[model samples]
Target: MTMAQARGTTDGWPDGTFRNPVLPGFHPDPSVCRVGDDYYLVCSSFEYFPGVPIFHSRDLVHWEQIGNVLDRPGQLTLPPSTASSGGVYAPTLRHHDGRFWLIVTNCADGGGNLLVTAEDPAGPWSDPVRLPGVPGIDPDLTWDDEGDCWCTYAGIEQVRIDPRTGRTIGEPRRLWSGAPGAQAPEAPHLYRVGGYWYLLIAEGGTERGHAVSVARATAPGGPYEPCPANPVLTHRGTNRPIQNTGHADLVEAADGSWWLVLLGVRPGGGTPGWHVLGRETFLAPVTWVDGWPVVGGVEPVMAAPPWPARPTPQPPARDDFDAVGLHPRWVSVRSRPAESWSTTERPGWLTLRARGASMDERDVTFLGRRQQHPSCRVRTLVDPAGGRGGLVVRLDERHHHGVEVGDGEARVLVRIGSVLATVATRAVPAGPVRLRVDVLAPAPGDWHPGKEPDVLRFGVESADGTFDVLAELDGRYLSTEVAGGFTGRVIGMYAATGSVHFDWFDYQPEDGDGDPTPRDGGAI
Candidate 1:
C-alpha cells in the first residue's frame, strides 16, 4: 500500500480550549523535537511490530501520526519468546544537522540499543546501526559546542560515542542517581541551555510513585547537583485525576516558550488503581526559576491550549478494508502475520487465515489499534464460516478477553495466565456476524479517589437484528497494574481455528466529539 499522510481538520471543536492526554492510549515514553515552526514526536511501541510511532504538529496542542520508523521486518525482528513488553523499549527522536535520528532498544533476543536515520521525519528510514556496548535502555544523544557527541542512558550512565558507527569512544561514566528516596532511575535526557547542562530523569518506578526529577552541571558529565526541590513534577500521593506522571521530554516552542510532553495515566473515579486506557501523552507549560525548569501541573482537561491553533490529522473512526493494505495505525503484537492476513482476497473483505497459535501464544493471528478512550465502542463485521476469531481486547498474550465465533459456538472468554473462564456462550447460524465491545465507566470505590475502572460489555448481532449482550467483564484485568506491561488495551480482529473474513471495523469515542482545529493553513 502507498503511504498516505493522515491529517486532522479540527474546525469543529471550540477554539482555544483542549483536552488532556493530547495523544491518548499507550503512547508512553514520549520523545519530542522542534525544528523551525514544526514539532515532531515519537513514542515507545514495545512488542508492537511498528516499533516507534511518529507524530507531527505545527502547534504543540494538536498532533497527527505521520508514519512509523520501523514498518518492515528488515528494520526490526521480534522473536517468538519476546514478552509483550520486551521487544522495543523507550525510543528517543532527535533532529540535528538537517537529519532526523532515532535511537531505541529492542530487548528481545539480545537485540540491544541501535540507531536509524532518515532525512524526512516521515521516513523510509535506514537499517539499524547496533550500539554493541551501550547497556540499559532509554538512550538520549546530545552534541556539545566543542563538536563532541555524548550518549546518556537508563542506568544514569554516560559515554562518548561515534555518530557514524554506534561505537563507544570512552569508558561509561556513572552520573547522579537522582533524589535519595526514588527508585528505578531511567529515561535520561540532556540539554545544553544558557551555558548550563540540564539533565532530566524519571524515578520511583512507573507506578503510583513515578516522578520526573532534574539536576544540572556546568558540563555534560557532572558533579551534578539535584534540584533544591527534587522531583520537578509528579502526581503521586495526590488527589489529582492524572497519575504516574513522569518520563518527560522538553521542547522549545516557536514562540520562545518551553513546553513539556510527558506520559501520564487517567484513572477512573471509584476504581482507584485500575486504568485500562494505559499511559498516555500529556502536554504542559514550563516556567524557569533560577535557570532551573519546572513543569506546570497537568489537569484532566485543559481549558485553553497553550499554543496557537494548528491542524492535526485524526485517525478515521472506521476502516472499510477497501485499501490495498491496513492503515498506518493498525499494529500487531510481536510479529505480524505477514502471510496469514490479506485485504484483497475477497476485494472489500479482510481475510485472516487461521494459525494454530491461539491468542495466548506470541505468534497469534491478530491485528489491532490502540484503545484511545475510556468510554468508547468497537465493532467489526466478520464471516466466520466454520471458523473462529472475532473482536478481542488484549493486554498481552496471557491476559486477554474476546468475543469469538468458532467451533460452532459464539462465546465470550477471559484468560488470566493458566486459567481460562468462559463468560457466556450461544449457538450461531453459519453466516456472518457482527461483534461489538463497549467500554463503560468504572464503579466508584472507597479507596479510589475518583478513579474509574474499565467495565467492558460484549455482544453480537446478525444482519438486521439488534446486538445481544453476552457478558460484562471488568477492564481492570486488562490494565497495566494487573497484566504487567508497558502497553495499553488494544482492541482488534483475530482468527484462530479456521480462515475468517472481516468486512469492516468501526471505532469512536462515546462523547461523539470530532477532531481539534489545525493551525491556520498548516494542514499537510
Candidate 2:
C-alpha cells in the first residue's frame, strides 16, 4: 500500500506499537524540545538551500513540516563551490522564556555558528545572530537557574555566552570527553535536569561505531561524574536492522516521562550493506536507573508510549505546481535564485531556467525532495520543446541517474563517479511527456549470496497509460557507502539547458515487499 494509505492505520500491529524512524529519510542530527503540550524538532540540512527543516507535533508520533528556519537568502547562502555535505550542520532547538531559540553551524565560506529566535515555532524566524566566538559545529544552547546562557559544541567544549549579543562572556573550557578512546567526539548537548546538569554527547564518528555517552555534575561547570552505564545508546557491532545510532536529544513530556530522539540508518542488501535513505530520526523510551538514564533498544517497531497515538495526515503525494510558493519539502542544491525557478512563469507549471549544462555541475537548476521510502515511484510531466530537462535522482554532481527529454527523444542516463553514459533512448512525439522512475526492492534471486540494495528503473509513459522502461540500474551506486558522502538520494526535476516547464510532479511510496518485478511493462 502507498504511504498515504498506510497512515493512521494500525493494521497488523495489535500490540499498540509504533514504527521507529518517526521522521524518515535524510533527516539527521535531530534535536527536539517540548513547550507546553507541543513538541518542536529541527534536523541538519547539509548542502541544501532553505536550511534546517523544522516540524511540530502534539503526540510526538505525528510530525508535520511547519516550515524551514532559514528560508531567506539572507539567513543562508551556499556558494556554487560548496561541497556535497559542507553547508549547514547539526542544529539544537530549544524554547526559553517567551521565544524559541535555535543554534546551528554553517560550514560554508564566511559562515559560522549562528542563532535565531522567533515567537512562533512555524514562523518568520529572525535573521541569524552570528556567533563568531563559538569555535565548533553542533552548538547547543542551555540556561542555568540564574538565567545565564551557556554554549556547548562538538569538541565537548563549553563557554558562558550572552545570547542577546552573540558574544562570549568567558573563554571556552573543555568538558568531559565521551567514552574513553572514542574517536570524533561531537554533537554535545547540555541540560539542567533535577538538581544536576547533564552533558550528553555522540562519539566514535558518525559511522558504524557511533554512540551516545553522558556525564553529570551538581554545577554547570564542575568536576562531573560519568554515568556508570555510559554510551547510553548505540548499535555498533550488532546485527540489528538499524545502524549508526547516536546524536540524540532528550525531552521531558508534560506527563513527567522522557523520550530520546536520535539518528540511525537502515542498510539493505548484502555484506558491507549500503544505505540510500540517509540517516533517519528515531525515537526511544528513556528511563532513569540509579540516577542514570537508560535508553531502550531501537528497532523497526516498538511499543507505543503511554499516551494515545495521534497520527497526522501525511503530505500530499502529488504537487500540482499551482501554489504561489514551494512547499517546505522542496529543496535545491547550493542556492535557489529567484530567476532560476518559478511557478507563476507558466501559471500551473514550475519553470526552471538552466544555469549549469548538466547534473555534473553543482549549480545545476534542480529542485528535489528526499527519497523518504525504501521503494517508491516518482514521475514528472515535462515539456522539453522549450528546453532540455526531466526527472533525476541525484546523490551529488558525480553520482546520479536521470531520464532526459530533448531533441524529441527520452534518454536514460547514469553517472557514477567519472563515467556518464546513456543506457537507452526512445523517440517520442512532441508536447508534454511523462517520465518515470521506480525504486524497487531487491528480489531474492537477484544475487547469489550478496544482494543489492535496490533497483532503479527509468522510463517513460505513453498516452495509453503504459510505462516503457528504458534501463534498470543497481541502487547501490547512489548510496552513501559508494558515494562517500553524508547525504541520501534526492529525486526531482531539473533544467539542463534553456528553460524547461514541469506541468506536475508526483511521488508515491510503493509497498516494500522485496519484489523486483516492474508494476507495468511495455517495450521501449
Candidate 3:
C-alpha cells in the first residue's frame, strides 16, 4: 500500500493536551533529530529483523514509521541463535552536514558498534561501518565546532572518531558517571546547546529507579559540572502511572522551543504492577534553567507543544498481506530469510514455511508486530490444513500464549518458562478458520482479589462471526516483569509444521471506553 493509504488520520485534541507515549508499544531508547521543519526518530529493535524502526513527524507528537534503518539482510544480520533482546541496542540518529548519520550497537555476532549514513531518513541506508575500536553499547555521535566527531557511549566514555571510516582518532576517556551512588549509568548522549557542551546520561539502572542526569563542560572532554537538580526527570518512588523513565534525547523545534523524547513504561493490574507493552516513547517539554536544561514531568496527559498540532497518519490497524512486501510494523524473529516467507506465493495471502517445529524453537518461522496498545484485539484467518500453525502472543520463546490449529482440533497453548501446556482445545470442521486473541482491562467488578494487568482471551470465531473464548489467561504472564526481557509482547502468526497461509490479520485497539476503533478498511 502507498504511504498515505498505509496511515490512518487522527483528530487533534481540542483541550491542547496530548497523550503520553507519543510512540507506543515496544519503542524503547528513543533518539530523535530535527531537519528543518521535519523530525526523525529511531528506536532499538532487539532480536527482531529489520532493526531500528525510523519515524517522521512535523510536531513530534504524531509519528508515522517511515521505514527500518536496517531493512536489507546485509545491513543487519541477527543470527538465529541470538538471544532475545540481544541483537540491536540503543541507536542515536543525528543530522549533520547535509547527511543523516546513525550510530548503534549490535550485541550479537561480535558486531560491536557501527555507523550508517542515509541522505533521507526513510532510506536506502548505506551498509554499516563497524567501529571495531569503540567498545560498549548505546553509542552517540556529535560534532564539535572544528568539525571533530565525538563518540559517547554507555560507560560514560568519549572518543574522537572519523565518521566516514569509523576509525578512532584518540583513546577513549571517561566522563562524568552520573549520580554518586547511582547504579548502571548508561545511555549517554552529547549535545552542544549553546556556550557549553551538555552530556546527558541515564543512571540508576533501567528499572524502577531509572532516571535522566545531565552535566555540562566547556569542552567536549573536560572538567564538567553536574546539573544541581541532578536527575532532571524520573518517576521512581511516585504514585505516577508512568515509571522507569530515562534514556532521553533532546531536539529543538523550528520555533526555538525545546522538547525531549524519552522511554517510559505504564504498569497495570495489582501490587508490583506489570508492564506488558514495554518501554514506550514519551514526549516532555524542556526549558533552560540557569544554563542547564530542566525536563518537565512525564504524565499520562500533558500539555501539547506551543505550535499547532501536526498529526501524522497512524498505521492501519489491519494488514491485508496483499502488498509484495510486509508492512514496516510486521517483524520476524531473529532472521527472516526470503525462503521462509512469501506474499507472492499465495497472491493476497501471507505464506510461511515452517523452519522449526514450534514457537519454542528459536528458528521458528514467525512474523509479528509489537502489541502497541494496552488493550487490543488481534484476529487472523488461517488455513492450517497445509500444516500446524496459528496466532500467538509472545514475550520471547519462553513466555507466550497462543492458539494453534491442526489435526481437526484448535488448541490454546501457554508457555511460561519451563512449563508448556495446551490449556484448551476444540474440534473444528475442515477449511479456513478464524483465530482471535483479545487483551482487555478487567472491569471494577471483575477485580475480585488479586487482579492481573489485563485479561487475554484466546479462541476461534464461529460461522456466525461470534468469538468463542476457549481460555482466558492473565495478561501479566505475557508482561516484561514475568518474561524478564528488555522487550514486550509481540502478537503474530507462526508455522509449527508445514506451511501456513494467513488470509489477513487484524489488530483493533480499544480506547478507554472499551470501544474498539474502527478497522483499517471498515470491514473485511
Candidate 4:
C-alpha cells in the first residue's frame, strides 16, 4: 500500500494524543509563561513583520495565535541587511508586577537589545525601550524575592537593571558558561525554584549538537555549580526523530507539575537530516530528579501527557479576506504591513500597493502566512490591473517561487542565488486570474541531502473550469537547511510595479504520513 493508504486518513493530527511540535511551522525559540490558569507563549519572528507571534493555550497540546507584539512600524524596523534569519532573535516573555514584558534582540537595527510591555499581551504593546547595557541575544528578565530586578543574557552574564528605563545599576558579571566543553552557550533563563536560583542555558550551536544545561546558586548572582548530570535535556546524536532540540522555557501548572516548552526540527521522510518546516515548538514533561529538573524525551506524538487533559480551541483552515483588517496570522517582511497593504479599501478584498523593492530587497509588497505542513495547497485570486502580481511561495528574498500575471502574460518565476529564470510563460486571455501552488509531500527514502525533493506545482485556473500547469519546481530549495536560515516557507500574495487586489486566499494541508524521502540533487 502507498504511504497515504497506510495512514487511512489525510487529517494527520492524532486523536486523544498531542504531537511533539505543539506549534508547527516556523515557530522557533519558544518562551512560555503562566499567568493564573492560562499559559502564553512567544517565538522569534526574524525578519517577518508583525514580529514576535504570541500564542495562548489552556492546554499545552492546542494553541491559538492571539496576536503579534510588534505590529506597528514605530515599534519595529527591519533594515535591508536584516537577512532571512537576522531580525528579531530569541524573545523571552515574562509576567511580573501585573504586566507582561517581552525582551528581544533586533540584530537588523543598532538598538541591540530592547524591551516592550503591555497590559494585555493580545494588543497594542508599548514602544521598545532600548536596553543599551544588555549587549547580547536571547535576554531574560528575572526578579529576586526582594523585588530586585535582574537581566540575564546569553553571554551567561547578569546585571542589575531598572526594568522601566532599561538602565543598568552595575556592571554585568559573567556567570557559568554551561557544561565544560559545550559550545555556543545561550538562551539563558533564570528561575528561583525552592531554595536555589536555577539557571538554564542551551549550548551546542542550536543545531544537531544542541543541548540544554543547568546550574544553580544559592542566590540569583553568584558562583554557580553545574548540575551533576549536566545537559539535563538534549536529543543530539540520537535517532529520536526530533533533532536540534534546545532553547526551552519552564512553566508550572496549577496542579503543581512542571512542563517544558522548547524548539525542535522534524526531518522529512527518507531524509534523516533535512527539514523544511524549521524549528517548531515542542512540549515535554519535567520531573525533578535528585534536585535537578529532568526533561523527558519527546516522541513524534505523545499518546498521553502527564498533565490533565482539556479541550483545545480549533483554528480556521482558510482565510476568506472578508475581514476589515489583516488577520493576526498574516505577516509581512522587515516592516509593518499596514502601510502598504489594506483590507478596508476594498470590501472583501486585500489591496496591495506595489512597492519598488522586489523580493531581493527589504520592504517588498508581500503578505503571507507560514506554511505549517509538508503537503499543502495554497490558492489565491488576483486582479493585476496592468501591474505585476500573483501568489508566491517565499523562503526569503534570494530564494522563492511564484506565478505572476502581468505585462499581458502569465509566467512562473524561480530565483536561486543570483539566477532569476522563468520556468514557463504563456499569453493569457486577460481577465481576473486564479493562481495556485500545490506542494506535494516527498516520498519515503527519496530525499537526497543538499537537494530539494518536495515538489511544488504551479498552475492557473482557466475560464473553462480547468487548470493549466505553469511549472513544477523542487520544493527542497526552500528548505531551511539549503536556504541557510531559521525560517520555513511562507505562501502568500505579492505585487510588483503597480497596484494589485487579491480577492481571497485559501490554504489547506494534507495529513502527515509516509517515511518520506529527501530531494534529488539537481540544478535549478
lDDT, candidate 1, at 519: 16
Better of 2 and 4 by lDDT: 2
Tens digits of per-residue lDDT, candidate 1, 419-482, equal 8888799887667778888776543232345333656778886567466778877667788877
Better of 2 and 3 by TM-score: 2
Candidate 1 wrongly placed segments (more than 4 Å): 1-15, 269-272, 303-306, 443-452, 512-524
After TM-score superposition, what is the CA distance of residue 217 in candidate 2 from its true location, in Å? 0.7
Q: Give lDDT: candidate 1, residue 183.
A: 89
- Put down candidate 4 lDDT per residue, 332-396, tens digits, no spaces: 87865555787877788888888744666666888899988778877887888878888988888
User: Candidate 2 or 4, higher TM-score?
Assistant: 2
Q: lDDT of each model, Cα atoms only?
A: 0.82, 0.88, 0.88, 0.82
- Our tally of clashes for model 1 stands at 17
* TM-score against truth, every candidate: 0.93, 0.96, 0.95, 0.92
Question: In angstroms, how far off is 25's CA in candidate 1?
Answer: 0.5
Cα displacement (angstroms), candidate 4, residue 245, comes to 0.5
